[model samples]
Target: MKHIAHFFLFVALQILLMDSLVLYSTGFCFIYVAFLLFLPLGISRVWLLVLGFIVGFTVDIFYDTMGIHAAASVLLAFLRPLVLNLLTPRDGYDSGDAVNIHTMGWRWFLAYTFTLVIVHHTAVFFLETISFQTALYTMVKILLSTLFTALVMVILQLLFFSSKRERMDYR
Candidate 1:
C-alpha cells in the first residue's frame, strides 16, 4: 500500500518536475528510478520486473518517449540483484532492510545509485539515438545526466529520508 503510493509519487515528480530540467540540450535528470531502488530487498524478481515495466511505462506515457523508459527500467530491474549481490555486506542484507541511504549507509548507497543510474542513462540515450555518428554526444549525455540524477537522488534521500535523528525511547 505504502510503496504503491510512493511509486505514483515518484512517477508524478519525474514527469511533472524533473523531466523539464533539460541540461546541455542532450541531458535530462530522471529521479524516478529512486523508487525502484528503494523497493524492499526481499521482493521477488518477477514482481520487481513487472513493477519496473509498469512504472517505466507510466513515465513514458507522460514523457512521450515511447518505450525507452520501459526498456531502461526493465534493464535496471534485471541488473538490480546482480548489483545487490556484488555489494552485499559480510552478513548479507536483512529481509526488511531497504536499499536506501539510512539502511545501506552513504558510501554503499552512492555506489549503488551511481552505477544503476549510469547504466540506465547509457541504455536510454544510446537506444534513443541509435547511431554511432553521435556516439560522443550520447556519451556526454549519459555521463552528465547520470551525475545530475545521482546528485538529486542523494540530496533527496538526505533531506527526506535521513534516519539519523529518529527519536528513540528508552524505558
Candidate 2:
C-alpha cells in the first residue's frame, strides 16, 4: 500500500516536476531513483529489478527517450545488492532494516546512495550520448547529476522519515 503510493508519487514528481529541472544545464535531479534506493533491504533482487524496470519504463514514457532510462535503472537495480554487500557491516543488516539515512546512519547511507547514483548516472549519460566525442561533458553531467540527485534524496529522507533514534531522543 505504501509502496504503491510512493510509486505514483515519485513517477508524478519526475514527470511533472523534476523533468523540467536542470541545474546549470549540467546537473539533473532524477529523484525517481530514490524510490528504488529506499526500498527495504530485505527485498528480493528479482523484485528490485522488476520495480526498477517499471519505474524507468514509466519515466521513459513521459520523457520519450525510448528505453534509455529503463536500461540505466535496470543496471542500478542489478548493482544494488553488490553495493550493499560491499558496504555491509560486520554485524550485517537487521532483518527489518531499511535502506535509509535514519536506519543505516548518514555515512553508510551517503556511501550507498552515491555509489548507486553514480553508476546510474554514468549509464544514463553515456547511453544517451553513445559516443566518446563529448566524453568530458558527459562525465561532468554524470558527477553533477549524481551529487544533485543524492542531495535531493537525502533531504527528502530527512523531511519525511523519522528514525528510532529521532523518536527516542525526542522523549
Clashes of each: 0, 0
Off by over 4 Å in 2: 165-171
Question: lDDT tens string, model 2, 21-85?
Answer: 99999999999998898877777889999999999999999899898999999999999999999
lDDT of 1 at 114: 89
User: Model 2 residue 57 lDDT?
Assistant: 94
Say which candidate scores most in lDDT.
2
Residue-wise C-alpha lDDT for candidate 1, range 110-171, written one tens digit per residue: 88998899999998888899898999989999988998999898888878775853322222
TM-score of each: 0.92, 0.94
**Local distance difference test, per candidate?**
0.85, 0.88
For residue 119, what is the lDDT in candidate 1? 93
TM-score of 1: 0.92
Cα shift from native, residue 1, model 1 (Å)? 2.0
